[model samples]
Target: MSPQEKTPATLPWLTDEFLQKILRDAGGHETTVVTSSDIKPMAGGGDNYLSTMYRVSVKTKDKEEAVSTISLVVKLPPSGAEMMKLIANSSAFLTEIKLLSDILPKMFSLLRETSPEEQEEFGAKCFYAKNTMPYVLIMEDLASKGFRMAERQKGLDLRHSIVVMRSLARYHATAIALHKRDPALVESFEENFYTDSRGFVSNATLPMLRSLAEVVRSWPGFGDDYRGRLLKRADTIYDDVMELMKPEGNAFNVLNHGDLWVNNMLFRYEEVTGEVRDVKFVDFQLCRYMSPGIDLQYFIHTSVAEEIRAERVGDLLREYHKTLCATLEDLRCADSIITFQELVDEYERKALFGFFVTTMILPILLSDPDTIFNPEQSHQKEDEAIVTKRISNIHFTTVLKRLLPIYAKKNFF
Candidate 1:
């Protein structure tokens, strides 16, 4: 096929016309000419499982001969037709597209009205978004602006965690304020990782539990009874998880960045001092309206470095709650702030969810990044060697050893 004839399979929304439109939108340029455009697909793993990102570098010149390079990222549903169909049927990607375009703007406007001078930008600037099938998102390239992801294996430390928690506090607080303004605004954010039409999570979690139980059984200290308890929990795991996400007894709730792990967040550091400057959250595809505790517990355990997590967990939660109350006060939602005791109670209730999530992702995170695992088929492939191998990997083994005992004492597993 001719270069002009090639289609990015109903995707590749970055066409000549789109290039002109986004440029006009991004820079407010009256007229711009695209001299050349280079599009490169992002490498797999770490970002999330639901979409693909393409980095587009466009060289443009105006009528005045002033030239500039515009760096953008184009995000699309999975390239596989089956995976695309599944996500398209669910509200995951649709929720994110709508969020970046419509909802986050309202939230940001609240921030501007309340605390403009203090907070940095909340997320990547969206130049354009289309919510229909094979949806597309075009936003500024964060990396070009000096943002980099924290090393997933190494994890975030105290300073990094403080910055991140502050951002999350602002995010959840703004969401609560917005929700109070319009109750229906959050109706669309009700679906999450388990809402796949094909029962993927149910299929995937059971096998993962069985595998985890087997490995624990092989460990030096854990006995058969421990394995039995682990396996027994699998019987009601899905229902148990879904229940935690629902509003609990009039407790405060806000939207959750459902997959809140290290890879989904990015940090920018000061150029001279190397101190962390700000935080930005990406990948809201799995977001749902749930307790902020879910995000807190998951981030504390799975993303923070172990020593910091052990020594300063209380300090971290205090930072989050203090910021939460402060931001709520800015928005006049101080009445919505949970008490310190209540915050700790809520986080403890959601701690099991964090454990399950950490157990669920550790293998994938520890595995070779070169090997991309497909979430769509992960459920039915019980016999796959990667699952077993990753379960037994020494890195995974060490984490599970510490994790299972800790969670078990809390009656989480």
Candidate 2:
């Protein structure tokens, strides 16, 4: 088939007309062009399992220059009607579309106007989205800019954690500044999963909690008392988790990159020194307005290694608070509204937020793709059994042994 003849089935919302428009806008010229062959699927991390990603390379020729190539990453909702329906019913795709199309740009624009010096340092530049069904988002491909994903199994060390925390601070600070400048925009971020109870009661919730309980039961030193406590807690995990998800109604509230983890962030390193320098976050499907503690706890729990977390979680939280204060000051907001102590206290109170989230995703993070059960195939009885079995993989036991004690000591359980 010719390039112009490619249908939505092949490229979703991508069409020759939309391609030309994207190229022209990106290049700031009208002569840009591309072909179907220039678009190809790109390998993304686990978060991308719910969506489709593509790298589009277009050759553009200005009136006075030779042809040059422009690259963009196109993200679309999952193709299956059932999957799309589920996503639509939840806050997933709509939250992401609003974030990339509305909130981020407004925040960046405000940053440029108020804090021009730091404006260019934060966030990725997303291209305009058509914002129709099957939701397409075009953005600059970070890979072309030397950004790479951190390895999931290895987890992040102190330096990598610092980079992500600093970036996250800036992102959260922007939301605060945006709230100050445009409360309506920040208020609109309330349309997320946390605002509703349906997400906590989803089919995956009970099974995940049971798997977590089983892992706890299988731990070597786990006493019967603790195991019973964990199982009883599992029965109420959804309600407890929902309570943590509720808004704190404080000055510290900001828009969170609801799904913060190793896979959701990308980093650029210094070539010679091997030093981590820059970080950018992706996957805003779960973005929400909540206490910044939610993002902090979730990222540290799921992405940082247990050893690093054991020794340096306190330092890491301080570093994040430091950046958050500095960024808020830069944005002309009150840095003292949420003190460092308040942050620590908030984290302590909301620590179960991380525990619950970690239980759901840690197994997936540690498991290999071949061994992991396919969610799409779960309709089959055999596939359902496979998925149930895989959920109690040995990695869960290891993670539970390492983390449960810490959670208990902190009263997170």
Candidate 3:
């Protein structure tokens, strides 16, 4: 399918004809055609640019052979309008897909070859095919897994959290390994991912701040004094946030599932016993390398509640670094000097981001879905414009409140 064919609204990229060609290329008979392509909206998939689907296919090599079933999730990239890239950025949208295609399989292989005990710890089995824009990621569907994080209140438990921490730690450790083992391979991958997206984040976010200021004004608990504090903080702290968008801080500079929240995780479980089986990390559109603490802090702050997070942040950070140390030791890599204390320091520095987002972003995000997701329900001419402005204000203010104390205490800046 052409790049134009894919949009955030609907993925026309996963048409039957195109899938048939892919199956044919997978060493199946030419006559092995997709008899049916069932496309259905997947729940809890709102944070991405693509229209995600749990696809069920009926395929037949010949009339005599029983039509085989193929279950997968088809991910199409965001439309050009949905994403605004840098001017000099040439096919950066496409380049991200290629990066994932290159990195994920290598990651999977390491899990299988080096860390078999941690195999089930990671997410889906993913393979990519380039449409006109290098789009379309076909992956194992976790529908039957019965783990859904749609509700804002529900999130990863202690068990799931530990596993994800280990997996993420190992992921970064292995990337370091790859760089040491084959600097050429690492360099090539880095080249494709070379563009800095901080500009987009900075430019695109100002309007949201204004919108958030308005929302704070209207909300019941926020008084004029409180709103002023929030707004003042928003203006000052926003610059710091934008700074994070830039590529810096080696501790933060690990490839990350950019939106590593609960919704992106799918868990398998026993049908009768209702016991959990496996957790798969899905969605790669927002995947980028950044402060490794961001994902963990983001997930912990946004997914878990204040009470739980306050209690467990230190423990979780500890687990993450310990796992990293263990994984690097196993790989016999010498670059594993990061310690639990260092991780805690990183958390203290970055965990403020979690507080900022959870307090500001979650309120509206957890608001009634019809108001948030449906255009028809919007009374404003451009609901997104309104939402964006308000959220940004809230984000900036909230971030400032959380950051000032921490930044001052650490005297980092």
Q: Identify the leading candidate in terms of lDDT.
A: 1
Arrange candidates, best lDDT first: 1, 2, 3
Write out the backbone clash pairs for model 2: none
lDDT, residue 142, candidate 3? 61
Segments in model 1 whose C-alpha atoms lie over 4 Å from true places: 1-13, 116-118, 196-198, 370-372
lDDT of 3 by residue, 123-193 (tens): 55544456454346675566634655444544556666776676678777776666566656644433222
For model 2, residues 1-413, the per-residue Cα lDDT tens digits are 65546544557446656777766775565665554336787764344556778887766665666776767788887766656765566667777778877788887776787675655444456776756676777888788888888887677999999888888988888888888777777777775654442543335445555555654575577666566666677667777776776667654688889878888888998999989988888888788787888888889878887678778988898888898888788778864457889889988777888787666667666656554534443333333444456565664555667777877776655
> What TM-score goes with each of the models?
0.93, 0.89, 0.73
Sliding window of 10 residues with minimal summed lDDT for model 1:
1-10
C-alpha lDDT of residue 187 in model 1: 53
Per-candidate total of colliding backbone pairs? 0, 0, 14
**216 Cα displacement, candidate 3 (Å):** 5.7
- Native-to-model Cα distance after best TM-score fit, residue 191 in candidate 3, in Å: 11
